[model samples]
Target: MYTVSVMEDFIAQHYLTVPDPGPEGEVHSHHYEAELTLSGPELDEYDYLVDIETVEEVLAVVRARYEDALLNEQSKFAGHNPSVEHFAHVVWDLAADELDTDHLSTLTVTIWEDDDTWAAYEESV
Candidate 1:
């Protein structure tokens, strides 16, 4: 299988509702780094798994949408905590809508909340 990945970073604020709760429920910010990966069994006619330009475009869109925003207020988070894991899935969902998934058979999103911690989500086509 062939795979291609794109990466981007943004800053956002969110709060967690579980674990210690309390002040953690208060909004905090993170310098978020997101990585999107797509994999397929074969390359497209252009000899690439997918267009790098398209991936960059999608990542840009995502960065613009979330950068400097309060993620907990977004409808996408709704009732769930805006944890790194949840953020990864949200990134995957956003990319899925913007990407041409016909050729790619797998999609994975990784979100890094800090230098030491990250989470990911994956889907099969």
Candidate 2:
């Protein structure tokens, strides 16, 4: 299978809402990195899994939507903790909605809250 990926980094703030969250319960900023991957067994006529420019365009909008924003206040995070795992799923939904997935078999969104901590959500297209 072939895969194409686009990534961007942004700063967003959120506070864990779960009980006994400790310091994480306080609003904090994380330098977040988001990566979106498209995969399929066959490439398009243009010899690409998906158009890189198109992916970049979608990623730009995704970046702008979250960059330097308060995740807790975002509608997508409404009633949900802005954890890395949830962030990945949210990003996946956003990107999937904007991209053409007819030719892809899988779409994956990975979110890195920091250098070492990260979470991912993958779906079949």
Candidate 3:
């Protein structure tokens, strides 16, 4: 399948909600990077898996909502953990909410908490 990916970076703060989160339970910030990938067996007449610019526009909007904010305070995470895994899934949902995916077979969202650590969420669109 052909794949097209777009990436962006933002900053956000969060504190884990677990009973024994320890250091993670404390508020902290991350220079986060989110990459969204769209893949499909067939491309449009233009031969592009998807428009990179369009994808980026969607990401920009989504990322802006979380920029410099605390994830725990967002209504989206009211009953959820603000971990990398959940964050990636939330981003994927945000992107999919606006982007047309009828031509795509799969979507994957990767969130980098840091250069050395990351989490990804993938599923059929």
Candidate 4:
């Protein structure tokens, strides 16, 4: 299988809603880095698994919605913990809307909360 990936970075604020949580329960900001990967056995007419420019544009739209904002307030996480894993799923959902599922066979979204930690969500055909 062949894969293609695109990455982007953005900043956002959020707080976890875990019971008796620690410092993460308090609102804080993160310099988030998100990577989206698509894979398939074949490429499109352009000889590419997917268009990098299209991926970039979609990522930009996603970033614009969350950049410099409180994710917990504006996202479905309003009453839940906005963990890295959850954020990955959010990114996947957003990107899924833009991808051409007809050609792509797999999708993975990775979200880095910090230099040492990250989470990912994946879907396969």
Candidate 5:
């Protein structure tokens, strides 16, 4: 399958809600990098997996919403842990809502909370 990916970086604050969260229980900032990958067996009429510029535009909005914001305050994160895993799904949901998926086979959201730590969520379109 062909894959097209776009990435955006932003800083966001959040505190874990799980028990014995320790230092993580306190709000902190993560220099996050989120990458969205679109995959399909076939390309569109223009022979593109999707338009890169269009994806970048969508990611710009995504970055704007999360940059310098507190994750726990967002409706999508309400009662959620705000962990990287959950964050990945949250981003995936937002991107999916804004992007056309009829021609795509799968969408994967990978988020790096730090240089070495990351999580991902993937699903069929």
Candidate 6:
């Protein structure tokens, strides 16, 4: 299978809920990094599974929507914590909605809250 990835970084604030509430329970910013990966068994006539420019366009939208925003203020958070795991899925949904998935086999979104920690969500298209 062929795979392509697009990456971007943004700043956002969020708090976690579960077990003990610590400083993380307070709104804080993370230099978050997100990577979106598209994979398939075939490529188009242009020898690409997906257009890099298309990926960048979608990523730019995602970044613009979330960059410098308070995660808890977003509709997607509703009543849930804006955890990295949830963030990954949120990004996946946004990117999937913008892409033509007919030729793709899978889509995966990985979010890094810090250099040492990250989470991912993947789905078959």
Off by over 4 Å in 4: none
lDDT of 5 by residue, 1-125 (tens): 99999999999999999999999999999999999999999988899989999899988988999999999999999989999999999999999999999999999999999999999999999
Best by lDDT: 5
Residue 52: error of model 1 in Å?
0.7
Tens digits of per-residue lDDT for model 2, 1-125: 99888888889899999989999999999999899989999988888889989998888887899998999999999999889999999999998899999999999999999999999999999
lDDT by residue (tens digit), candidate 6, 1-125? 99999999999888887668788888789999889999999999999999999999988888899999999899988888788999999999999999999999999999999999999999999
* Whole-model lDDT per candidate: 0.92, 0.92, 0.92, 0.88, 0.95, 0.92
Q: Cα miss at 34, model 5 (Å)?
A: 0.9
Model 3, residue pairs in steric clash: none
Model 5 scores a C-alpha lDDT of 0.95
- How many pairs collide in each candidate, listed in order? 0, 0, 0, 0, 0, 0
**Residues 27-46, candidate 4, lDDT per residue (tens digit)?**
89999999999999998778
TM-score per candidate, chains pooled:
0.94, 0.97, 0.97, 0.95, 0.97, 0.96
lDDT of each residue in 89-108, candidate 1, tens digit only: 99899999999999888999
TM-score of structure candidate 2: 0.97
